[model samples]
Target chain A: MTADRPLRAGAGLKPEHHRHILESRPDIGWFEVHAENYMGAGGPPHFFLERARALYPISLHGVGLSIGSAGGMTPGHLARLKKVADRYDPFVVSEHLAWSTHEGVFLNDLLPLPYTEATLALVSRHVEEAQTVLGRPILIENPSTYLRFEGEEMAETDFLRALARRSGCGLLLDLNNVVVSAVNRSFDPLTYLDTFPVEHVGEVHLAGHAVLGDIEAPLLVDTHDRPVSPEVWGLYHRLITRLGPLPTLVEWDSNVPAWPILEAEVARADSVLRAAGEGRARAA
Target chain B: MLPLDATQQTFAHALLRPELQVPVAVAEMVGPTRERRFAVHRNNVKASLVATLAAKFPVIQRLVGEDFFEATALVFVERHPPRSPVLAEYGAAFPSFLGTFEPAVDLPYLVDVARLEWARHEAFHAADAASSSIGSLAALADDDLESVRLTLHPAATVVASAWPIVSIWTTNTLDAEVRRIGPDTPGEIALITRPDEEVFVHLLPQDADRLIAALADGAPLGEAAASVPDGFDLSTGLALLFSAGAVSGLLEGMSE
Candidate 1:
């Protein structure tokens, strides 16, 4: 198996900047790609990804396994995801701590999972099942949401902590998601950062978001289309300060800009890494 | 014990139903109003699916206009939701759905355009293959030339539409069309393939039926040629197809 760069600070490899990434060979710790996007048999996305893989440590972040669903997991989705993970051999395979598919119909969004013991137990089992199937310790990412469950019995952070403990998996702390969810829910973001079992964190994700509506009841959607917000970056600096350097990816999915702009995001993340010390890969 | 199945079912309901209050039994997340919280997810599911369709059928969206197209897509989502998580392969039957859709019936070419778009999508993601060049067959005996089975490219798609779908597709997607963009023919055959990892479109009616039929039958090159028109130049056809990375499997069939 190929070992990725030991340092952290990464970003989602945008298609728009494929040529620029290839031509300039910008310095980013590593690159993460949504597994579904590269699932196509043969295309520029896969073609360029192959080229980038040789130069960088790759992480395959999945958006679709429907891990938190009540209708059990989709075998087809798992099979497909396994096929990709085998082919790419990503250093880290991660998925959202949310459900998207129900009754065989895919919603295509990360549907929230309640922070109750039952939900936790179900999700933990699913995570372990997924990790065992994928033949690796997959990182489960906490999702950003605008909704709260009425009967949720636990905080999301605690449930995630329990999930990692039970599943023998790791955590991919999306700082922007934390900030977005915290701001949206009117919770203390620092407690989540401070209280989260930092030892379980294996990777980090930094991405741009859309500020929807008013700032008070503002739903900061994890759109991944704009520049990472100052607040979110501030959150990342906080994460680097505490969680220490981890493989962080700049995610820009929609309205993708030119390669240089994306590369700049990479550079910015690299700057954080330098400040945080080159220890993102300091053995999770 | 937390009822895992029941919580998930309730979660699904809460996500899809805009007005449905969170089931009293479900777990609490980090938010005040369950509706406001679920609203983000509702928007996400709808928006992502819509965007996936938009990405797949750019020309169709352009033809129908944004508002009408989005409405059509939302309707499609309600009627025939995606069965797969892979968005690329999600709308395989969307073109067929468009044909039966009442509002889209007026624009008969819309279905064909969708078909062509889907074909392109298939070509983009299909498997890679080392194309068997015409040279590989040049050594074949005269008998094998007509009866031997030929392989089609993994990325190749045979789309037979009654409307000038290929022209319409190219007019919108290919930037810089010298020809006037007008609905012309009732039928067109599009050969979509990704030879150099770049998706390309080829207009092929003369070679479509014989090819699709031969590939479907796995007929040897010689036998497959006999099935085509008498004047069909095997060399020229094979060369055009082979060079374009359309010939995928070309093993000689076991002699019967």
Candidate 2:
């Protein structure tokens, strides 16, 4: 998959755009899919994915692996993920750093985890297990946190860097998540990126967020329902300029718009990527 | 500091029970803003699960109004969270949960309707299998037909209900025309099959349900037809199975 040139900008694959994508064959970089949606035995999801796989490079972004859970990963879930990975041979396989299942109950949402030694060890162990099962290193995306945990611990960046070092897995740095988490926790997004170990980043994610709570003290929810916000787009430009161009994705999960609208987002990302490449070439 | 397991358990408890305070470790990070920050995670968990259930049981949601359905779904979400990561297979226990729910007792048919929807959901995701051609069966000798045991398609499911659930499901899903079902409506037996790519729901004769059920349980054709009620036409059942493309294969004498 990497035998060609570097990865390019893509969009999160939605079922509504499957036919249009196949028919139009747009110039987007690639497509990403939620691994859980394709875990079924067989159906239209698989039917469309098979055709899409033939056309573009596919990335498997999983939401429910629960890598941060202390109980360890479920065998069944791991097996199903392996089945999908083996079938698609995805160009990149990624999962969140958050845990979703606890005590046999799946919350269906990515729950936050505390940045502590215990969590680092737990997450690393889980990542190692997943890599062993999949026979390939998977990229772990930093989660968008709503709340933080109180404890003597390392910073989230240090924890993720250590996790990558220990498990030999790369990072999927979601720029929108950084913006949301920074705004929610009252931190500087640039400082967070400055301290981030961007060398380990294998991919980048850009998505939209919703502003909630009172105006005096609002919170940014990573809703992924609309176009990438201006602030998030600015962050994406800065990150790409710093780390050079990485495979970026335009994720609009909920309230997905028409084909042209989503394609427009991808085009915007592609343009930024080209500009970033030009700047790097001039500097070199 | 609480152990990792204890912290997770406490967080989960707080998410499910609003009255409970956020775990001390989690609460301290936000200071005075803890309540609002924690509510986001709580709301996301509930809202996502409720949406999942609503998608799986749309007919039930329509049968009950939107407000009632959301309320009932929230209750169900609290009582029974998903046990699997696969959202498509998340609400397997909902039909039984609806049967015991207090508010839904007045609408007894609602439980069966949920069951029918669940059946269709299952059939839609079941494994793909090629249906046995009628020519393959025609090649069999007359003497060999009775001893053959037929296998239904992997995606085929038979849901028998004491209420007219087939009509209820079709009327609500296929047509927008509102029509009230009388209390005297007869019972129904629905056969859900995904012969090719699309899932289809066909209402079968009352006796065909028993015959199909027996055949699904690995009974030979002769014995399965004999077990049906007297005057039950075996040919009709065979025709229904063939037309629906539900029969996947046939084995002689039930031997592997």
Candidate 3:
């Protein structure tokens, strides 16, 4: 795990709440920002990001690195990521495990990847390339996948563990994504979490997902628009209780509510971490 | 199973083309729910990119009603999905697309208005540099002034249009009332700059774009000023530039 991981609970920063967060100086553990938002040469995004960086530890997360792309990664994106990472020196830097670009077209979503030996090697090399350019190791988040691919290869966890071991990168275990993927794929969330490479997990993401279609076999979409779901919260608590509280972030990107709402989510995660820490201390 | 690259290529190809069948690879894996699951990715890609366009070109979206804008935008997205992930740089070709688009032919000014908005977007995110005050120009002698070269601020841009785009942009972006503009309205030159925190769009007198373009092309003040038409308000143009902090630094002529 990276030494710069923020162990407490944090909130994803939204543009709407930039002024409010800076003014109020909320007592949150840290702030996570999407790297794509700040890639512009200079503007309000940079201005507010600099101010926010001064007040809180920031985790730079990239949604567009396209690490799993077989056509290779997007050109110049790594340099852009490097610029943001260099500017912010974020406590932790991360990107998704899925590809969003193919044949020179950026799809703008975290599309899934097949877990094959070829993909594992490609992703590992891409992660190494990113770490080499940024001069620091980065964490790879498990994407909230909607569908699986037909392939004869390893399980998702095995692939991720191998990628981490090969590339020396850490894992950003998004619990909401775990629940979302589990429900959509008709798998047990607990079993998946039980097998996750928790030792390599440096951070955890808890976000709200939208359940659409049939009530019995709903398709869980990783919407990140509302408060964290109870199922996700339960998984988060279970993970923290066992993993001893990695850095947790509550993400609400769309239809964002007031700062207090997001702050409350962070507070809830913080309390969970505190309880887990207390339990550990009692055990000691 | 498809090769890794072929799998991504097939998946990506089908994502943009909804009419195509979900790849047999994905279909076979997810079973009956495959189409709905595949639609999730399709919806996400188009919706997010459309949302990005909407955010970048709000005035374009407003000028045409939301439905028209989105309908046209979907066509644009399919034909020209972003080549890069930095969405701020996505719609560089949109203004030109609007110009040739048959649906927008009635509103001839739509293309230029889109250009003006794109210019404002560019200026808003261009590299930040300190603007040199007009006080420096005052130091130059009358004869030396024409030879002096001024550096434009990095965030400054000149958007020349054949319609009253500045007013259109201003009215749409701000809380101002909708001022009626006619077909015969004279063209305006928009000077966009973000000297400090806010992006300012100032409508300069006609033909100011020529001088600004010349100056931006590394021409000295005299060379650029000479290229403009007679009766052109050099003072108004220079004043707008300096007031907006568009002038960054001055380089004395090499003739000296």
Candidate 4:
């Protein structure tokens, strides 16, 4: 469902900043939470979420749906997500286009899936199932990949477009993922974005990455532990310019800074969004 | 080309089991450096799972130190990967695993400490319930009290340990003050309840454990007190429950 108000720049909600958010009620456009964290029967997570929900729109960003698993989506996981979505009435619900669970074991990381026609059908069906079960269209995000599988039928963007078309789901375009995957696989981030179906992009994610290995053969890890790098910001600027200011989120999951630092990142994203909105208006 | 199911199963095997060769489908894509690139996923998966355990059991990690905890947690991760995608529910089998672990045998109290941490983790996320106030109980007629079963809040949990787990958990987590535990230290019964948004652990006194334990099991006030030692005071137990917000409701006509 569309938000009551236009979605703007936001940050990932963390327990460390829950009280600060509720007390300060900062000028964040909205907040997002990992749906798995709130899957428990109920305590502080629900407590803070209820308080935050009253003041701001929330997006339930799920990290554990394993939507690309070959075996199919877990009914139990979808049920839990539906429960949380119903309880919080999140403005948007999203999951990664990667699998974390395999053969009854949850690897707990968004493992990449090959973009094959068979895999495409599987993910498309799974996304459709999640949307039907949640009774709201879910947003699927592209994952950062360190390696690609051989014998893939299409590019990652093509797979996402097909999945969106088949499932009628929107996209959560994570710019940092684009930059990381591009650097790791030796491709241009802008080229990947050019092929991306921008019309289906409902939300945009901006986060930081750590450069690992030597400078000669660098690997960009989507660590989300620090401030957004300038390169990702550039890609974000490009994204909003083309896509016209979707709901952008600044995610700092690990080594999270204090409220002011995260607020600053959100502020940075809001400025880009405002600039893009202005540019779009001027052109119109 | 391998089917999608085989490719995923092989990939998962490679990530979790280093002995297995990198899935052939993945190897050919990245050319010669596929193994190292695949190791990134392996490292990320292991590190993320270890971090999840570390967050859930900070006391255990602190007691054992970071390096030891990570090494031990890696073993736990391999043996018991999460069944659900919810990382919060991942370590239900960890405390028991620690109990049987050979390396941690020296620290006999480690298992109980893990249990206490797990209990707190569970209480932290357990369902919220409106606690029964003393005023609510005051309205109950004296004759009906013996047969009325008091329901404990969903977040209420009692962890009984033959070791001084409460003192160990408190001194390790909350305080800088150092406390030593010897063989002669008394065992403890920790009552974990989330009175508000914060979960707190209180050491039960005398027979309060038996009484509260019984009450949690749907024992009425009189019968719960009867299960405790002689000279068990129902008023003291009731006061503790009310103060802790452990009692959620009174089930009328329900008795032990």
Candidate 5:
């Protein structure tokens, strides 16, 4: 078994910059790739991923596992994910708390689920199943919500805490999601984070959000384009200062900037991570 | 209050069908109205899939204007939502869908163009394998040539079209200039291969696909070469196949 390597901060791997990354060998913490993007049998994705794996620690973040599906998880997808996980042997493997599949169709978007006892039970069962198939404890991320359900019987943080405890899985705290959900749902972001089960967090994600609608009441969309916002950066500071450093990833999925621009984001995140680590060291 | 199963089924149904009302369970949030808020998920489901299709079929999008392509893609997305979570495999049915799309019917060759594009995509992601060279075939004894069955690389595929799709795909892709393809333009066969990890689209000679099809069917070299009509340019075909590294191996000991 490979020993777990430490990852401070990393950038999402983009196909356009794969060759550049291999050639330049940029000084970043690690690289995280969407598990779905590398699910292909063989090609440039695998070719570059293999080379990158040799250079840096890798993390597999899944976007379509649909672990919260009410209809239950697909065994085929779980098997395919296991194949990828075994082949890459990434330091961390994480998936969203949202479900993207309904009936038989994949919606290609992380649809939110109600925070209820039944929902928690379903997600925990699926998460356990995935963990068994993957042969490892996976991290479930807090989703970015646009609307709430009246059927919700519990708080989002309660649901996540219960999920992690029950399934023995870690949590991937996406700070941008916190800000987006807070703004959309009329809640304080910091208050929500205070109640979060930080001890269970294995990784962190920071990204930029798009603000839609009017200034009086803005709707934040988790569009991972552009750089991380100051608000999310502040939240990351709050989390890292308290939680110490984790494997933080700066995600820019669409409108992916050039390598230098993306590298700057990774660099900034690395600096924040280093400062937090030093602060924790001094306190100890 | 709706249960988890009912809530998901209702939300999912409303997400795909915009005409349907947002499920009653989705309460009014702080910022936007429930309809406006739920529209976010609606927009995300269709827009993201549309974006995936657009990325996969850029040449098709280029052929039809962006608006037309998006309109047609939205229809295709609704009609054939992806069955798998891998978005890369989402648009396998798009070529056939375009064939019947009334708005794109005027561009008769669009379907073939989409096919060539899809072939390139499949070749880009197909299983990686070592390719055989012409020397491998030459090394064999002349007596063994009849029994030698050439195996195409896993990434190799032949797309034969009645329209000049190769030129259409090329001009639109490499050169920014869009040339009008006349109805009288000659048909072409495109051979897509990713031999050394880079996908290349080559215009093959007429009826080259038949040789590829025969070889792909595990036919022996001599029989596959003979399957073509007179003046099949067997030497050139063999050279092209080997040079592109499309021939992965040569098999023998097969009974005819």
Candidate 6:
């Protein structure tokens, strides 16, 4: 179960806990950080992150590239992303399946895109361009969406599968997003996961999400402020069974607690990976 | 079956416009009354992005307070959603946006505050460089100081503003003494640098104008001092600069 498939279990590092994380250097496999947070050169963030980089495999997760927009990718954005990737040398890089910009102004949100032939071509090229600049493949994560485009020609799974197949990039399967999007969109979460092309998955993200209480609404929000929901955790366990111990992250970005609270979350993952070795997840 | 191009547009439109009752086939599995679930995704996208902007421009949020800031933030979001997924680089043009905003017109100084914040943000992430030693700088004779080109750290930022933005920003900032907060006077220049994680800002009217002019022309230490006269204490400034490691090196003055 642990055959060195690039596994890491970590929480998103916050400014409040930077010193604590670095000082403790807990037994976690790796730590994930937002690429934008490290865009600056001389600061405590950089200082600590660099020091920690010596010990942990860092992952750069981007939240702003509007890859889905028909308007095309920004050269400046790609150049900046490349520079940070070069500077940090993060072991893995990932971004949402959603789009965030249009005509230069950024909404700073992961907005949905119509999954069409044109979009497929646009997003695929963006991914290809990113890879070309980086000289390596990045993991394009499936997004948690609130609304569906009325005219989508391809299924979300098909679009992602096609993107991975064509661009040669890996997938960062966010199970909570899968569950959130599935429940919100009224698709079977298992069917979605089962139909998902798990072969290309390089990492998995397990984060908390709050369900918008509108039965009339078809959206499940990705809040990332609380503990991973039990249902989402169950999905994560299933993911490990299939993907076989992929790098898993537990992200708690808002109202983040002390290091000990986050460490407990990491501990759960450690046991999950440990159990996987014994072929216990299938039984559980 | 929806056309690939048509479906995408409609779907994106439906996703954004929650009021739309159109039951596109892709969401059919969501069954009737499925719009609520879809709203979750919309809420997430909105909430997260808003929070990002808030984090980046806390000073602006503070000036306007939470409610007004959030309302304006929403408008800003719809108009200028981030082009890149990188939140750090998301609000590059926010200062300009704040300038043209009608609601913010009464607070003319708001835009400049954004500019200063952006400058601090920019300086914080700017490339690091080694500072030149004071010993070598001391060797430069009186004649050489005026015409030589002085290398400044990439993180050096000089911002000139009409409002007491420095004080206003100071008062509003988490680091600033809250009771000292007051209005800004015009034509003030603020210097910002991040030799460390904590960004430092200094308000120097005469020194700022002279230094900014001199720095722009790539003036050496002596020349920069000449431009500022008694206004700039070159020795003191140089000491600060050397300690802060603001200089990469000093260039020999060809003009002298």
Against the true structure, whose lDDT is highest? 5
Tens digits of per-residue lDDT, candidate 5, A1-284, equal: 12474647899989889999999999988899988888898999999999999999999999888988888874489888988989998998999999988888898889898898988999999999998988888899999999899967999999999998899999999999999999999989999999999999888999999999899878999999989999999989888888787889999988999999999998898898899999988988
Query: Per-residue lDDT tens digits of candidate 1, residues B101-172?
Result: 898888877887898898888888888876777787777787656556677878877777777777888878
Badly placed stretches (over 4 Å) of model 3 are: B29-32
Instruction: Give lDDT tens digits, candidate 6, residues A1-284.
Output: 11333465776768888777778778878888887777655666678888888878778888766677666664477777778788878888887777665555554567676777777888899899888988888999998765566567888899999999999989999988888878766688988999898998888898888755556643467878888899888988887866566788898888897888888998898778677756855565
Determine the backbone clash count of candidate 3.
0
Q: Assess the local accuracy of residue B188 in candidate 6 as a C-alpha lDDT between 0 and 100.
A: 66
Q: What is the lDDT of residue A200 in candidate 6?
A: 88
Give the per-residue lDDT digits (tens) of candidate 3, residues A12-69. Answer: 8888998998898989889999999899889888999999999899999998889999
TM-score of 4: 0.96
Cα DockQ of the candidate 2 complex: 0.64
DockQ per candidate, 2 decimals = 0.52, 0.64, 0.65, 0.70, 0.82, 0.38
Off by over 4 Å in 2: A1-6, A281-284, B29-32, B253-256
Q: Stretches of candidate 5 above 4 Å error?
A: A1-7
Q: Please tell me what DockQ candidate 5 reaches.
A: 0.82
lDDT score for residue A146 of model 1: 75
Model 3: how far is A191 from its true place, Å?
0.9
| Tens-digit per-residue lDDT, A127-155, candidate 2 | 99999999888999998987878774888
Q: Tens-digit lDDT track for model 4 on A48-144?
A: 8989999999899998888988887754888999999999998889999999888889887788888888998899889888988898898999999
Residue A221, candidate 1: Cα error in Å is 1.3
True contacts kept of each: 0.66, 0.70, 0.75, 0.80, 0.85, 0.53
Superposing all C-alpha atoms, what RMSD in Å does each candidate have to the true structure? 3.3, 1.9, 1.8, 1.9, 1.4, 4.2
Chain A TM-score for each of the predictions: 0.93, 0.97, 0.97, 0.97, 0.97, 0.93
Tens digits of per-residue lDDT for model 6 on B2-91? 544354455455544456655464454444354554554456556776787788788899989999888877777667765555566667
**Is model 3 an incorrect, acceptable, medium or high docking prediction?**
medium
lDDT of 5 at B18: 77
What tens digits encode model 5's per-residue C-alpha lDDT throughout B10-45?
A: 888888887899899999766689988998989999
